[model samples]
Target: MTGPVLYGIPNCDTVKRALAWLEDRGIEHRFHDFKKGGVPADRMDYWIAALGWEALLNRQGTTWRKLDDAVKAGVTDAASARAAMTAHVSLIRRPVVEWPSGEITVGFTHDSFKQHTREALM
Candidate 1:
């Protein structure tokens, strides 16, 4: 309730770890499931502005690999990359965190989350 909102698939191991880490630290956060709710385009736009589409887009995932070479090849800039990610939401890297301090991050790390949360509550 007081911490950042965490977005990702429920089954992702990284998402599980991120949630566990927050729990262990007594950080209350809202979890948004991409599978059921889908990623909001405005949120994606914010992420693209903050971290860039390159980082937000998970090119290493099965989703990305399954994309046609042409689609993958077309992601040369933020707009194109966002289009690709929009078409395949699963191509987003797991655990995109929208910190309460108004910062948006693409992936998860316990230390990083802890630091950001602490700063936000300060």
Candidate 2:
């Protein structure tokens, strides 16, 4: 079965776990390393449109925590959030899986992955 494009920093524990889960399940996914490849602006735009910036942004992460107070404060709406995410990809959630069927998901969870797979298979 065709898998999704899993985008995240390799060192992130969440991303590592997601990758391990895929490997353990004999799933094939394309890994996009944020550090090396940088965020794809067009893909980001699509995700922002579909998921909304609030849903895609990782406000609880260290990256968001480390941002300047002003920068953090500036992300008040979808447009601002997208701008912030464009400037700092780490602010975007991890393991953003763009499935073979063009469905996009943020974050990683067993149930979520299963659902995505089911949707793709359909």
True-structure lDDT of candidate 2: 0.87
User: Can you tell me which runs of candidate 2 are displaced by over 4 Å?
Assistant: 119-122
User: TM-score of the candidate numbered 1?
Assistant: 0.90
Task: Name the Cα RMSD for model 2.
Answer: 1.7
**Per-residue lDDT of model 2, residues 5-106, tens digit only:** 899999989999999988887877899998899999898888988988888999998889999999899889988998898788888898898988877888
Which residue pairs collide in model 2, if any? none
How many times do residue backbones clash in model 1?
1
Model 2 lowest lDDT segment of ten: 113-122
lDDT per residue as tens, model 1, 48-91:
88887778889888998888899888989999988887778788
What TM-score do all the candidates reach, one by one? 0.90, 0.90
Whole-model Cα lDDT per candidate? Answer: 0.85, 0.87
Clash totals in order: 1, 0
Where does candidate 1 stray beyond 4 Å?
Answer: none
